[model samples]
Target: MMAGLEERLDKMELAIRKQTFRENSGRANEVNFWVFDYDPKKELEVRERIEYMKKKNEKGTEGFQLIVFDLYDMIMEYLEEKDFVNSYGRFEKRRGFDYIIRAVSTSMKMNEDDSILIRKIVEQTPENAVVFLTGVGKCYPLLRSHKILNNLHQSVLKASVVLFFPGTYTEQELILFNEIKDDNYYRAFKLVK
Candidate 1:
């Protein structure tokens, strides 16, 4: 399974490097977006493979640049900068999961914050870049691919974006980690395995 997955990743990298979107394409309308689904149990292994591939691609003269944006790290940084850690820590200590969920939902506008951060990151990326968006499992039930991609402007992001999703994609629906089944999103294409 790992070998097969690696092969798929290689193919995905090639497709991303080769794909080009027209200027008139609307947000989330271009086929430049891809999802790499994998077994949730092998998250660590999958991440390691992706990292290895990223390094390998960087060393080669592929013409396209690889940029990784980890959502977990972004959320942590946002919480730290907003000084909400102490409060969340207290909530976690006292109330546990429920309080933490409520606090996160109330404090962080997940889509808005992620959109801003992603836009900033995308804006800084050079031409012929492939942005790898990861850490979807970490932000389950909060940060969703459809929401983020729907919010992003096609004009600002000239390069392809691949989301490393630890989930299942059946038909057009997305089931994150095999738990949260999302609506059918028509914009992005699934990376063939």
Candidate 2:
């Protein structure tokens, strides 16, 4: 599985460089979005592959730049900077899930509008870059993959965005971590098996 995934990623990188990678055609056969899905269970393996790719990039593999946005690390950094850990440490009575939601919400300032976090992600991304989005499993109830992808703007997504989902991605529906079934989203394409 790991070797196969690496081969797929290599092909994906080639496609991205070509800038002709389309998920599917629109109503008039127009090119659709450039969102690719990968198996979530291979998160660690994917991370290693990305690290290797980054090294290759450093060694002068050019054309498209790879930028990785690890959600778990980003959220943890935010919580620590905001001093939420100390507060949580003092109030050890709260349930783990509740504490997590509170911490994530407080750190991300999640409101009725959940797109804020996604927008922040887009803002952090560089122009004309291939992005690798990871750490979805760690953010479970706090952040849903479908929610972020659904809310993501095409304009903001200058290049292909590969979401390393830690779950099953069927034709249209996204089963997050194999527990939650998100709504069917059509804009993105599933990486071929």
Tens digit per residue, CA lDDT, model 2, 1-193: 3237777778766765555443323335433334445566677787787788777766555665677877777777776887887776665555566776766666575542444466667787665566777787887777767655665633345556777777777757878767788876656666544
- For each candidate, the alpha-carbon lDDT, in order, equals 0.70, 0.65
Candidate 2 ranges beyond 4 A from true positions: 1-3, 22-41, 89-92, 111-116, 184-186
Candidate 1 lDDT, 1-193, residue by residue in tens: 2346767766766665554532224354653666788778879987887798689778857667788888777777888988988988887888997777766655665446345456566677677777788888987654676666665534367766677888786538888888888884646667666
Candidate 2 TM-score, C-alpha based: 0.76
What total of clashing residue pairs does each candidate reach? 0, 2
Q: TM-score for each prediction?
A: 0.79, 0.76
Report the number of the highest-lDDT candidate.
Answer: 1
